[model samples]
Target: MEWTQILTLAAKEFRDRMRNRWVLAVALVFTVFSLVIAYFGGAQQGAVGFRSIEFTIASLVSLVIYLIPLIALLLGFDAIVGERERGSLDLLLSLPITRLELLLGKYLGLAAALTLSTLAGFGLVALLLWQRIDTAGLYHYAGFMLSSVLLGLAFLSLAVLVSVVARDRTRASGLAIALWFFFVLVFDLLLLGVLVGTGGRFGGEAFAWLLLLSPADVFRLLNVFSLDDVRTLYGLASIVPTSLGSPGVMGGVMLAWIALPLVVARWRFK
Candidate 1:
């Protein structure tokens, strides 16, 4: 409830991550991967150069979907459990800080660290490609970066929830990895499997709505539908309905993904 308590805890958490060089490492990884994708993504096709912004973004979207969630899960999977494992949770709670303050502070601090690293990593690539991309391209790229941040925040929320619910750090981590695998890898395959097994008789509008259930898919749709070329490339034009494809609607869904987990964590933490 108190902003001062929350901010103080957040500052400590942020400083801890910075001192350990986690942010820099993540940023570097993003920068390297992004630069390579931007410049050399066409190497397999016998051409090697910076491609169009749409193609670059489309490639990066796949990268972010796979990478960001894993990073975020690892970052926050132990947030609360680690403190408890070290016997610091009780001591921290004994201070003036309330439970809500601690939870919010931890989430905010981790979210800040992830946001900075993602922006710095991808923003550098943006700067490098600035001359080649026009204003509209720049706009789309910025949207991609923002949506990537939301995706990270959403997964970090899930990590925090796992931390709150699990009995120990090991369990929390296992849950986090299971979550990453489910949302990033298995969720889509299962959906498609059902559609195929049912021979397309089972899914129409309902199928598209199911994609909204996973933050990764929502992020995918958000970025894909925003660009005509990329959307056509993904062949999602028929699968995703117009109403669900709106950026505002998908953004709201992403926000829910970020908030709902934290709400559950807060409840369980108490």
Candidate 2:
């Protein structure tokens, strides 16, 4: 692949998203919700102020898991199908770029936009709380932001694959929402139901491995296992064995989530 052509296409995609105000809207949403959760999240218990970084991160994880995946799916579900519907895909194909370069360029561009929005939104909160938080706390918060970006990219990869396989934008969107539901809402519940139904007898050792199947779960474990207080708050200390909880392991799994879908998308698009 020619780096010049790939970078040019990526820049075009990024500029298109910027022109559409997608980045600004997402950044504002992140900033507003993050500030609210940081300051008033513990209001019910009469503890309304800048809490510890671990506590803040724990609160944000729930929000990120639900919000990021949905946002990512929506952002990328139309990457290919929308172009096709607009009668632009064929026109673009008639150009000098190859399919692999086009697909990679699109994914990289979307990933950049998603990462920027995440950082801008969360980075503002980090700045506001910097004086109050210590070095370790800052590090933890940074990790959360990084992992959040990874989680978004993973889902966006899936969206690109859906766009490639679906015949139309409508079906692509339906598939995106279905994916969000399956990974974010249904996957863990199904696992718990199976374990409960079988009295914890079935899916023994393999069950722990199964969590890797859902990118959201991998993201959860990556952040939750990082800090002591946050881990206790999440209550997954026992369930997610020490062996599988390594940052290296979880990061690799998240990378796989990002890669497998993109590989399939490249194939399908071809």
Candidate 3:
């Protein structure tokens, strides 16, 4: 539809984000946290004679799993709802732009920022690692960074969808935070309990499905790039079991997850 309008609004949204001091602080915190984890974890692995590839994979996966969803939640949960609460959303809606443009522009802005941040962070880590050690893993690790960034955008869209429905920042933030906690922290624990209580009976099929439900696990699968390792680690699924699927299939699923929500959010626009 209005590509120019959408792009312009998206640019404005990106600029407006500069005024969001809290988000700036959070982004800084995320950067610091990733650096600390990477440095310390990489050092420990290097000392233990673990390969650089393994260290990078583990470090990046852990960082993205723990932090990305939180970042997405914080950034998106208040997207529309916050504006509505502040009386600015009404003014914006009163403008010439349609609701679809509003939603699309915000999503594009969030997605662009998320992508840029991950790419920049990965570049820094790659530079540091190159100075420290060389590994064939760099190539795969690059792919991991790219896929993880897309997955992070999926979570951002999920939060945006919540923001749209709730139409109030407080309620949407509460829901976003609660869901983040559930998926990040509690979901796996609950799954573990179920697996144990069932004497591991439900674990095989259930945990497989859990990957579909939990974005965190899907991200982990993306990191499992080596096919031999996928088989050794994932079993006889032919589709890279421990992973979400093979790289090709995994990419499709992750994109679907991201796109489906943005579509819904767009369609539901007033």
Question: Where does candidate 3 clash, by residue pair?
Answer: none
The Cα error of candidate 1 at residue 242, in Å, is 1.5
For candidate 3, write residues 1-270 as lDDT tens digits: 788888998887777665665445555665666566655664643553334556546665767888888888787887888888998988998988889888989988877777766666666666656755456567676777788788788899898888888857778988999988898899879987987899878775657667667777777676654434533443435433544566776777788878888788777656
Question: Clash number for model 3?
Answer: 0
TM-scores of all predicted structures: 0.98, 0.98, 0.84
List ranges where model 2 is wrong by over 4 Å: none
Worst 10 residues of 3 by lDDT: 231-240
Is candidate 1 or 3 superior in TM-score?
A: 1
**RMSD over all Cα atoms, model 3:** 3.4
The Cα local distance difference test for each model comes to 0.95, 0.93, 0.73
Return the candidate ranking by TM-score, descending. Answer: 1, 2, 3
| Structure candidate 2, residue pairs in collision | none
Residue 77's C-alpha lDDT in candidate 1? 96
Candidate 2 weakest ten by summed lDDT:
200-209
